[model samples]
Target: MTLAVLLLVSSALPAQAASNRAKQRKLTDTQTLFTKAMRWGEFEQAWSVVDPKARESRGLTGLELSRYKQVEVTGYSEIGSMSEPDDIVVRVIEMRVVNRNTMAERTLRVRERWRWDEADGQWWLQDGLPDLWQGQ
Candidate 1:
């Protein structure tokens, strides 16, 4: 019985690790998308990653993202995250941005709630509006 219990515990560890790795990947993907879009001055593309549900709830239009001009992301750090089943994850992402023209830089700490869509098999940032570049 002891041997059987040990085997079960070992098996569960690998599965749990796999689950954690998957969550890490999804969070990384979110930061990657944001970094790539902002670095290239592609605000529209960045908007594409915003949660559609959030857009509707917040009454935000895609045009709102146009407010940003040239931006370069210098740092991205995941400060917090929460896991709820396989479909709900919330993360606080901290980033440093530099204006391409002014060369001025500031750090924006944003709490981004992410939800995993089973159909899409991916994650979406729930806040939609990151409140980025405020007073920067």
Candidate 2:
């Protein structure tokens, strides 16, 4: 009886472990993509991570684009990550940078949010601070 119980427990362990690993990988991948997008000033690419409905509702365009450009000018340095299987957040230590024409540095902090996209089988941004899904 003890042997059978042990066997059953062992059998269930791998699946649970795999699921956790998958979730972590997804979160990491999302962070990497976001970092890359920021590094290159890919505002449209970054915006692609926003939930479709939010995109429609917010009508993010000119103002958002300008803000992203400001972020690009201030290069990002990742400070840390606060993440779970389903949600991942990154804190960036920013330094204000001159747009290829001058040289300067200023201090700032930027927080980004990420969440798993079940439908797309990937992870994506949850939009700006305060996140889209807060109460539920």
Say which candidate scores most in lDDT. Answer: 1
Q: Rate the local accuracy (lDDT) of all candidates.
A: 0.73, 0.61
Model 1, range 22-127, lDDT digits (tens) per residue? 8679767876786577556677777677778766677545456545655676776878878777567777778788877889989988777777776776678776
TM-score of each: 0.62, 0.68
Which regions of candidate 2 are displaced past 4 Å?
A: 84-105, 129-136
